[model samples]
Target chain A: MTNTEFIKSLSEKTGMTAEQLEPMVAQFIGAFARELASGRVVSVQGFGNFESREKAERKMYNPTTKSYKIIPKKVTLNFKMSATLKDKINS
Target chain B: MSDKVTLQSVAESFSRACGVPKKVAEQLARAFFDTVVDGLSNDESVKIDGLGTFRVVEVASRESINVTNGERIVIAGYKKVNFIPEDGLLVSNLVSDMPDVREDVVADDEETDVSNDTDETDIEETSEVDDETEDVSEDITTSEDEEPIDAVEAEVNMVEVPEKVEVQEDEFSGIDMLICTPESVEEIRLELEQARADAERKLIAAKEAHREVLRLEALLDKMEKSMVPECAEEEQTPETEAEPVPAMVAESVAKENLTIYEDIPSVAKEESAVETADEGQKAEEVAQTPVEPVEESLETVETPSVVETAEDENVTVNLEATTEEPSSEQEESTDVAPAEEDTKSAAEEAVQSTDAEVKQEDVTAEGAEENKDAQAEALNRLLSDKSAATPEPVRKKKDDGHYWIWILTPILVILIFGVSVVMYKAHSDKEKTELKQLPVEPKNHATPVKKQAPVVKPKVETDSIQSNTNVPAETTATEPAKSKAADNKSTAKPKTYILQRDETLTKVSRKFYGTKDSVRAIIRANKFKDPDNVPYGTEVILP
Candidate 1:
């Protein structure tokens, strides 16, 4: 979602005024998400983890068209479920 | 599919999609989060069945290990907890089934789609149940060709109904074989409808409850962040604005539903998504409710029953705030409206009026000072004149010159003409005697003058009253005090006197000083001896 869209959605979900919500969201995201963007792992006891990893840039050949192209290196957020969560889900 | 949703992005998107301002959306998201925290804090299972559950886990206190060094550390025993999303079920459900749902449902749906590829296919079968009644019959006919439920149960410990299948005829008549009956179909349909209705109601209640929790959480957060620590209050307090929003919305929706039930169409998945977003907003307001203690101190001066003093104070504060704000605003507007001459004229006029009131105050101060100086000079002249003229019988002296001009001159001219010397001396002597006698009759003449003074005072007072009508009553109070003091002094003079006979000391003293006790004072002043015997003919001076 775009920043504005996300803000609107959050307001709808939370019923908070946009004036009050903006700084809070900014602060929360600024604190925890940056580390993840830099390929750091965030692990909580029960909740999932947000981690970032660097994928090696590689060239791949298309099977049908016989075309070769390079895939750019990108960072991705990977989530891992806690054991408690896994148990709850299985149950 | 479920792409990475940063909290920031979600806050922003939620704001945009819900038509709420960005800041409010973020706070709402936080509030919802804090509500989950509170739920976990209290050890309540915050369950969003499809999404995730948040609960407090009683982690036994144990020694910790430093991951890098592999060193164990002492840990304390306490219950710790965390928030876990049931994948996307809770979050998506919060959005789903609610009108005005956020578009974030798409993210949730994509993830769940990948994880359970069969779920969507199952939904298709379930959704087709209403249309597949006859098809179910046909399947029953086909399944008759196969082994019955007992045979199936023998192979499996428990029969798990795949999404669409239902065991309609489970009751056995006499034989071990389970038989299908029309009554079973009717029961199944009834059961299905009842379950769907129950789910819808539960969803509604859950949405409302969640909204309330969220609103309270938001309020708590606000209070925690507020400058005044006292503003924070215990959660779940009613009588707050946050508490009522969801209730009001619920009431309004309930009322609307009652009237327009037929106008509404069948619920769709997309519609449910929108409803979830709407419900989230209500939840946020609920979370925000607990912080409303601050409102009581807002001192809404508009209350009709409010005392006049409070109203006046509030008005004064408002007036000051208004003045402060407008002056800066005025300056800005004036700068911008440089080309608008009329606007500039009006602005200047307002400024001029304010300055004029200040100038008026200065003028009033100067006027009062000048009046005091004029009154002081008049009083000094009156006092000095009285002191200077006391020794001389000044009234008679001033009249003597006037007599010569009128009477003596006329007589002298007659005498020079040698017309009647005797008559002229007699008339002239008579006039002289009359002039001498005039100063002695002070009381007889002063009565008319005293009476006239009272008359003149009333006229002066009336004139002042007419001229200074616009002046405040407080300003005119001093005028009456001055007039009354003058009248009081005039009426306070000693009125009785006595004459002495045969040079008696007491009689003589009483005649001079208007009091008999002055006789001894006179003896002391004159150093008289034998006061009763020698003083009889000695012409003793009266005190």
Candidate 2:
């Protein structure tokens, strides 16, 4: 669903207006990114976790070039869905 | 701690997590499970957004064997609920920090976020101490709001009930750390202490192993150093005395080594061996012979050696000749068998008495070197006794000749035992000095030229004995009359001697003169009274 449509549906279901949910959703997304960038794992209950993890630098072989190249290390963001969330979607 | 997670427990946990009464949560949980079952039964897929998906897929009709009954059955087609987790949710729930596909996806998401907008970044690190402590006491199977710690925003979403513990029927992961109980804190402290102690013990063991290795290396080095010196000594021997040794010289060296190693008093053992051999020979030689003839033969054996010894005028040679003659007589007697053993016994007694005399002389020779004068005197007295007897001392000389042969073995044993090497060494040195006097072509040998010095003595003695044997053989070559005449001629001059107990006139005659004819003469004088029997202690006058 589009953001607006989902907001209206959630407002109807919980007896809350789109205005309240809109800010809450914004805050949720913003806080998740902030926590993740800060290296804190943002574990959304029954949904998924957002986190940044270290990716170690290593040598990668290129078959076409017939040589090795260093793949630079980096901090990457991760999203892991909670088991409850996964089970709910399939059910 | 409970083995399984059930729906009721999850519902209770959910109820507590959401601040709802447990009955409402239980009813809701039942309805949710009922709806999922119904959807799967209708061949539809059900999705619970925050949880997971459950889909029913067709089960094809097939034959299967029943294990219980060994029967095959074709069951009708059916649908099975196939749940495929979305976004790898199942991977996130396992207990340890086992980075599954969930972590990989999270890492990807992290990268994507940073790439999109990198401003809201942090460098926060989780405390390893908290990680270690929480790892213990995690098996209680309770669900608290684990999302509250890391993300402040996530905590607002979880409505938690205080003073209520929901022992949930679901697995959770590292994100959860309970509000620390005093008991759990104590357990954590103990576990940390144990881990630290283990690390320290391992460090000590490693250090000890290193020290032991070093000690072993030092011991190996010392052994190698010690072995090197032995090799050097072996190497030095070739450089110092590089010459081939003669067999005789080698034998001499071995004898020296034997003397050093055995350290037994070899002379006594040698003497006993020689005496036993001589006794065996004499027992037969004097067989059926009266005592007088034996004394005659024994004297003859001693006479030649005494003359040879006196002619040399050497005390040492006198001793050796005296020692040698008894063995020669023993050797001669070894040839005769005791046809009449009574005379043989009497002969043995005479031989033993002579042996005692020889042994006394040997003892004198063995006395101190300063007592050589006494030894020479004793030997001279023995010599005088042989010459003074009017008749030939052929029998005594025979005994002495027997002794010479017997004495050789013990001499060789002692020479090869000790003195042989010393004599051989001296001979070798003399040969080296008189190289021109030596035969030049014997260079392959290490023997000395003057090796002939001691070697000639045996040949000389053997020649004398051979000539002596030749004289007897020549005399016996004639008819029996000439041999008897020769015997009479040899026994013509004799001295008077007393007869002992068991002395027949024949025995007395042989003891005094080495003849049996005197028995006839003595009986004629006694007028044939007890003709065969002559009583003991008779002073028989020699005819």
- What alpha-carbon RMSD in Å does predicted model 1 have with respect to the real structure? 45.8
Superposed on all Cα atoms, model 2 deviates from the true structure by an RMSD in Å of 44.7
* Candidate 2, residue B8: lDDT: 55
lDDT (tens digit, per residue) of candidate 2 on B49-167:
42346666666888988889999988766545554434424222221223343354345334433422321121111122223322111111001112112232222122111101111
Please report, as a residue range, the 10-residue window in candidate 1 chain B with the lowest summed lDDT. Answer: B170-179
RMSD of each: 45.8, 44.7
Model 2 lDDT, residue B233, Cα? 50
Runs of candidate 2 exceeding 4 Å displacement: A1-91, B66-71, B98-543
DockQ of each: 0.02, 0.02
Per-residue accuracy of model 1 over B2-90 as CA lDDT, tens digit each: 24455555556445534556776556555555554444445565653222345566656788898999998877655544445333222
Superposition TM-score, candidate 2 onto the true structure: 0.20
After best superposition, candidate 2 residue B399: deviation in angstroms? 99
